[model samples]
Target: MSEQHTYRVIVRGVWDGLSEDSRARLLAEVDDHGLTAMTFSEEGSLTYDRALKHFSWRFTVVSDAADGDEMAAAIAEDRAASALAALGHGFRDLRSTVTDLDTMKINYKGGRR
Candidate 1:
């Protein structure tokens, strides 16, 4: 049987100067990317120390049998990139993590050691 996998996209640094329209644009971008589920926190709630603060927007992308094996990974990646691009300012950086079904651990730049 084919193996299962999970993909996640974490977006940070949504500039405080962003306008209401821009925020909406970002949400649309996430949806356009084809993520399984997406959610954003209210603005002004996130702090520098805790970037994932109450205000920060967190989007979690899941790739499983429901997404169909042929196109889950590609869709997730595309969505992540698009969402990052939408944050014109206060957009610090975008981090992506992937994991296998058998091993729920992530393999990042650290070499998965």
Candidate 2:
């Protein structure tokens, strides 16, 4: 069996050509999409504000070690776009970045070794 790695994908984009009704509805429910609700999960979570100028979606994706980070990022970007479309939201300038937890290195400060 092959090993699997967990990747944290962050997809960012800007709202594009939102209708008046869509903007109003988003503003009304803005509180629910605030920074406080931001988290990384398989299903993804979105963070935005009243301005709605920009938004970010956080996704925790798992990939086979051989598939690597690029594939995971692509998957995340697709998932984010799909989720947004499902909610009837329009966005542009979509971009995604990914971090592979399995290969990440952390430096410990002055603490118990």
Candidate 3:
């Protein structure tokens, strides 16, 4: 059985400035990738560090990823980046954990891009 991947995405940009249509387009792109969009609060002052619009997403996806089959990972990463770029937003970090079907264990991993 293949593993399931849960991706935590932090997208930062000017969300308040975007037009309604732009917002819809952005969510639509997210939906296209089978990811149901979620919301994120400002969490601090308007002038908080860097002061960019931010949203957090959580979605689970499964791919036929073998030990070294990078195509699945690469495709998933590209699709996510494209979804963000379509709305003129910046793609930050994507933290994911792989759950082995047999072992049923969750491990946290990291990578910055």
Q: How many residue pairs clash in each candidate?
A: 4, 0, 0
Stretches of candidate 2 exceeding 4 Å from the true structure? none
Model 1: clashing residue pairs? 13-90, 15-90, 45-55, 46-55
**lDDT at position 107, candidate 2:** 89
Residues 4-113, model 1: lDDT tens digits: 45443343333455566766654555434333334332111122222222123343444565554334434544554454455553353433333334445565675555
Q: What is candidate 3's local distance difference test score?
A: 0.40
> On a 0 to 1 TM-score scale, where does candidate 3 land against the true structure?
0.35
Candidate 1 residue spans exceeding 4 A from truth: 16-77, 81-92, 97-101, 105-113
lDDT of 2 by residue, 1-105 (tens): 789999999999999988887899889989998988889999998889988899999999998989998899899999988988887888999898899999999
Clashing pairs in 2: none
Residues forming the 10-long window of minimal summed lDDT in candidate 3? 40-49
TM-score of 2: 0.91
lDDT of 3 at 103: 40
Which tens-of-lDDT digit does each residue in 59-98 have in candidate 3? 2334544542244334445555565566565446543333
Model 3, runs deviating above 4 Å: 1-54, 68-73, 105-113
